[model samples]
Target: MTDLKHLFFSLGLEQLDLSEKEKNIINAFIEQSTPRFNDICHQRQDKEPLALLLGYMTQQHHIASSRWIEQQTAYHQMQSVFQSSVGTEHASKFINQDVDEYILITLLWLLVQGANKIDYSYANEQAETLLAHIHEETKESNDSKEDEQLRQRLMQAFYQGKKTTQQSLFTKLKRMFRLTQQQ
Candidate 1:
């Protein structure tokens, strides 16, 4: 075999490396792993309904616009790094982290917003209810108790129809998430 072909052949032997055939086989396996598009959330209306639910969360529990903006910046930076690590479309498949602070913040935002639309008596209920609404494929994150608590508190405020100063909320979330000052 030629040098290039030999290199590819050598790559096939390593656990981390793959020949084109093995790569194709793995790709096919992954494609088969997921349910069909029609079975998944492929319909526009179906997607919109969920978006509305999330929007409700944003409307109620999300902190001020400025903090979200900051989180967005952090999120985008992480997204860039993630993309570099594993291309654009495949990043979510290979390394599906929260995609940055924005995702967590957005989740927090939605929790605050959506939960607020309902009564506070149902906050835990709301949390559980929200859990049922999502797909099983979504991985639960491993966050600290403090981070979780602070966000829940913020969510309570949103449900209570209040917005505290950005500094205080940011401080709690930053500390909870272990976000650095540089970030």
Candidate 2:
């Protein structure tokens, strides 16, 4: 496993002081969210839904927009480093490196946006619920979580929903699935 502390520090997210359980949750989230994120990026459709979700997380006050931007830039730099290092090697080498960094960056960003505060309600309920919504909206899975999605949707789905109301990280997730529900 990646040393969680070093990963966070590299990404400038060490201040979050996440517990072991919290680190596990973030790790699980990254594993579950990766395919969904990649699917959205590959679909060649509008990425606004996920982009909005990312914007909300990366822009949170505690995250410090400037620092987040810098970290994000650093992530890209890491990606470039991985790509250059694996020019003639097996593609998996570069992919694994990039994915690790991606997960770390994403976990840090999510934490800064208050992911750790999510109620999760049941034993692992919150994390799974959150993952299901992303998969549903991104069309990565058929499994559903209607109640969770509805509560999140209505909470965030108001006037100027996209333009004015800044949503919590999880609520902003409702945006991704809700838009797909209409299609």
Candidate 3:
């Protein structure tokens, strides 16, 4: 089982305390989304973008399914927690944004087209946005350099599978040509 705390930390909610109901909602979201996420990863063999996709999906599902009054309560509480943990300036980046709408659009796209058809570039952009927020909140001396390195690594990983497949194809073609010449 995936560790919820690790997932929350990746999502920039590490310091926040979730209510029992919120936890249950998150678990349900994970349960439902995991298969889709797995399928995408299996097809692409590129897991970077899809890493945060699950978290955004869970957040959207939770907000959309909750009653309005409950959502309001949870939103305010989350805002306060974020402000206190990361300071108001950084908190604003997470709380007062159209990110949720963007996430919803991505989710809608996924639902309509299915995970196997996901646009990796668009998904990577969303994942980078989420990581940027976390970088902003946790910035420190030399952290920008480290974060850039991390981003580069993620991008490399995203393309690595394709590179390997291309190399394999080239190798197979070379062997086949050599065999034809021998025959």
Q: What is the per-residue lDDT of model 1 for residues 51-87, given as tens digits with 9 covering 90 to 100? A: 4434533543333334443454455567678779878
Off by over 4 Å in 2: 1-12, 45-183
TM-score of each: 0.23, 0.25, 0.34
How many residue pairs in model 1 have overlapping backbones? 7
Model 1 residue runs over 4 Å out of place are 1-94, 97-117, 129-135, 139-160, 163-183
Better of 1 and 3 by lDDT: 3
What value of lDDT does candidate 3 attain over all alpha carbons?
0.48
What's the C-alpha lDDT at position 111 in model 2?
39
Better of 2 and 3 by TM-score: 3
Judged by TM-score, which candidate is best?
A: 3
Q: Tens digits of per-residue lDDT for model 3 on 31-131?
A: 66667666655676556543445445545544543433234555567778998999999987765333333333333323322222345675456446544
- Candidate 3 TM-score to native: 0.34
What is the descending TM-score order? 3, 2, 1
Separate clash counts for every candidate = 7, 1, 0
How accurate locally is residue 136 in candidate 1, as Cα lDDT from 0 to 100? 22
